[model samples]
Target: MQGGLEFKTEIELLSRVHHKNLVSLMGFCFEKGEQILVYEYVSNGSLKDSLSGKSGIRLDWMRRLRVALGAASGLAYLHEFANPPIIHRDIKSNNILLDESLNAKVSDFGLSKPIVDSEGSYVITQVKGTMGYMDPEYYMTHKLTEKSDVYSFGVLMLELLTARKPIEHGKYIVREVQETMDQTKDLYNLHEFLDPAIGLGTTLKGLQKFVDLAMWCVKESGSDRPMMVEVVKEIENIMELVGVNLDANSTSISASYEETSKGNSPYPGYPYS
Candidate 1:
């Protein structure tokens, strides 16, 4: 009964909003003391399935960028448009859904909460979110912010570029991701750590830019990370540098002018506070 009530509440809370990247709540049902929220079942399942290498579906660089853009839009909407603002509280790959066309949708709101912008210090409370993706600061001090999700998103980007689990290899890969841009820090020797599944076919500059952004997002201090909107723009820029032509919809190296889709707006909110 309690679980049903929780689902009902989450359904009611998330149903009213409509955005390109959020999973739409179609309806809800109560039966036999169980509450169920019906949603548009995404065909590609969770991003975790792709990240874990168990889905047998290979996500190319272009598709990956789209996924990132979609997710950021979802997070931005919750933080900016929702009345009083909603903090996802738990942002991880398992909560991200991919549709039949491979579009991304952010889901899971049972732990979401609303709070007004405040001049007070960030909240320090019980840490919530997946172990590998949880912000270290939140884990230690319980202070939470939208940036907490940015930290996790950084992990997700590294997962996309390197095809490694966030917590795998006993924190070795995570360390490399955190220190990729710092010359003094050494972890896995990133050049040697690319996921074998990807076969080193990605463009060098493209891949490096992705790595740099990933490292920036996972900075030890939450204030140092950029917002998801900025992250999306960074990825688009990297895509252009790599010859992907995000606006052209072609993976070919040829410089083409055919427009694919409108590019995302640069992050408008405060990335640091």
Candidate 2:
């Protein structure tokens, strides 16, 4: 009965969401008590495959930045534009699909939930998410919020930058990065942690900003994390600084930054006085 409820929830939520950066559901199947979701085939496979060398294609630094931005845009759309803002309870590289052109499309809506009340900041519910990507606050309090996704996405950013799994040999990547940042505080030393495949020759300033944003996202308290709209703008700024041109689609997205910024709280329900 619980499985049926979850499947119905996914179908109901995903059927209403339409975005360039989100995977589209073409159809589904429920035969012989077996359930199957049919999503548009993403030829390039998952982001996890691309980063882990499972996929033969090597992603350059520019392409990786584009992937990060594209994924951020998709999350921003979910948190801000969806009718009843959806929360992607599970966000990880494995769930991020890549098209033939390397455009990112967030997949796997099985754990997604909708925030039915616009005024409510969060929903109290049983926790459900991957180990490394789960938000600490949500894990502890069982109060799920949009910021929970921000924390997971922060882990995703660390994965993109370091090309390391969230957990390895009993060490969490977040702790490793934090300790390194604390010890060195120097960009030169930080390079040692970066994924050598795409990190070579990348601008240090841009990398620093990216790392900073990721750190902010993973802050202990959800109140400290930037909203998804802020995240989208920050990534755009980073890309522009690194000399990447904003495409027609991204240009339109940039325009919304200001309008969305007006009176929006960094922490939901805690507007600026």
Candidate 3:
């Protein structure tokens, strides 16, 4: 999969997709038998880095809300707004990229597939996605649907709030998060259970609300998961509660992410990391 020609096809496919929350393909290089995709170079790196103690920066409550909202916006667009719905079969923390301003962007479309119509859901013959992030229903039935992405998205949200890796050594960290939740640990002390790297100031109520929503997304039954539109509304509500104003017209997702990202400041002077 790593070759100049493969990279060419990838760029060609990605050029058709234009979304504020998606990592833009700035250009590509096919030189000396080396293929490289030149992306917009997000300064903040992947959500994995921030959640795994790699990034020195600590995301505060407001920024964390923005990151979650931004990622939801990206997935919502891929699921509903694209001309043909695109399923990010590999929706994981590593696939979620960030910008200089910490804006979330969906990356790595190698496993992406386009769904032309409702009937397409019934036709998928292969089950593909990350281990723990993969939709349980899809993982068992080999069916591909937008809801599958929702399921993976739920796992990503868990990583955000709990600051834990989605899967480690073939065991989903959800088991840990659920255990902590059952133990009645204070949500604000998520740093205790979460990746110690991301500074902790998140509210328990807010974190619990998102955890509930994330659980819905990763439901064992696909039909039970909410639609992308509903997901957008709920994420917006969460953001609003945290004081991020959202524009109504931007509900299309593409417009809304752009609307939110405009004039936003990067985490102040974190050495451009």
Model 2, 197-228: lDDT tens digits are 88587554487788889988988789989988
List the candidate numbers ranked by lDDT, top first. Answer: 2, 3, 1
TM-score of each: 0.78, 0.90, 0.79
Clashes, model 3: 0
* Candidate rank order under TM-score: 2, 3, 1
Model 2: lowest-lDDT 10 consecutive positions? 264-273
Alpha-carbon RMSD to native, per candidate: 8.1, 5.7, 9.6
Which candidate comes out best when scored by TM-score? 2
The clash numbers for all candidates, in the given order, read 2, 0, 0
What is the lDDT of every predicted structure here?
0.68, 0.84, 0.70
Give the CA lDDT, 0 to 100, for residue 252 in model 2.
73
Better of 2 and 3 by TM-score: 2
Show where candidate 3 strays beyond 4 Å. 2-9, 29-34, 117-122, 169-171, 178-205, 247-273
In model 2, pairs of residues that clash are: none
Residue range 1-273, candidate 3, lDDT tens digits: 454544654676588888888888888777787677888878888988876658866776667767877877778777666767788789888988888878899998877877865675544648766777877667656778889888788888878766766665655665555545642555533455554434444343366567778767866677888876677777777766766666564444544534443012133431111
For model 1, how does the per-residue alpha-carbon lDDT over 19-101 read when each residue is reduced to its tens digit?
Answer: 76888888877787667778877888998797676777777766777777677667767765666666787777788888988
Off by over 4 Å in 2: 182-188, 201-205, 257-273
